[model samples]
Target: MSASPGAYRAPGAGLRALQLLGIVWTLPNTLVGCVLGVAGLAAGAHMHLRVRDLAIVFHRWPWGPGGALTLGNVILHTGDTLDSACMTYAHRAGHGEEAPIVLADHERAHVYQYMVLGPLFLPLYLLCGGVSVRNRFERAADRYACEGRSWWPW
Candidate 1:
């Protein structure tokens, strides 16, 4: 018997396989994130798994300048809360809480990039101009957060 149209359904086998592949491909970066997460936890950060996003997030990470950083599927956030809302602490000109972009979505785009690029993501990200808006990856992630599509820089 089938459930209602809006009922939750498990992912198909092929989709699960692809998800597993992504997890494996991004393991190295995830490991680094895990290490940092552990350190954050030791320093009093709170951790939780966001099932819908399939990400581990550490809130109040005790580092960085009041924003979020994504490594693999892990998000290290430097605030008491993390959510799909425009980040007021991002310090971008003319963008505030009412901005269309969501911080969590932007970080999720980075997760997708790490899944596809694997270990190459960090070096390539640095070479592409690091955290600045000039970076293609940053631009793509911002676009993804604002438009809800097209996360890939290329």
Candidate 2:
């Protein structure tokens, strides 16, 4: 079957690993989630992913207002949501919710890294401390954005 546009597909190979890890790691904790889940995102993702109601996934990270990782998106804690934007409008700006501005620009840099660095970026990017990673990637994206590539809309 053909894929839809930006429907969020995880490549088959990646999906299998994610599923295996989820079953192994999450099955134990499922019961307690009957209580108010720490983050509704976890329950929601698990449900959608479990039944194949959604596409496969591999990585997801959340950014704080000042750019910090949300425990919900970290694999060791909440498992990966795989490219989730887990964004918020908490910090209203002149243009309103800055989450889109932050997330889109950030992820676009990731794409740019893939283009320029050609696969080495993720590994090297992960080596840095969390704060460094956030700053560096965002800056890389911003630099790319400033280049007037005319590819990214904004």
* lDDT, candidate 2, 1-154, per-residue tens: 6432223355487866765554444332332332223244453433232222211122222222333221111221134432334333222323334333333333433443433343344455566433442445544543433342332212
Candidate 1 residue spans exceeding 4 A from truth: 1-11, 87-98
Query: How many clashes does each candidate structure show, in the order listed?
Result: 0, 1
lDDT of 1 at 57: 92
**TM-score leader:** 1
- The TM-score of predicted model 1 comes to 0.83
Clashes of 1: 0
Give lDDT tens digits, candidate 1, residues 96-150.
4435566777777788898889899999999998888578898788777666778
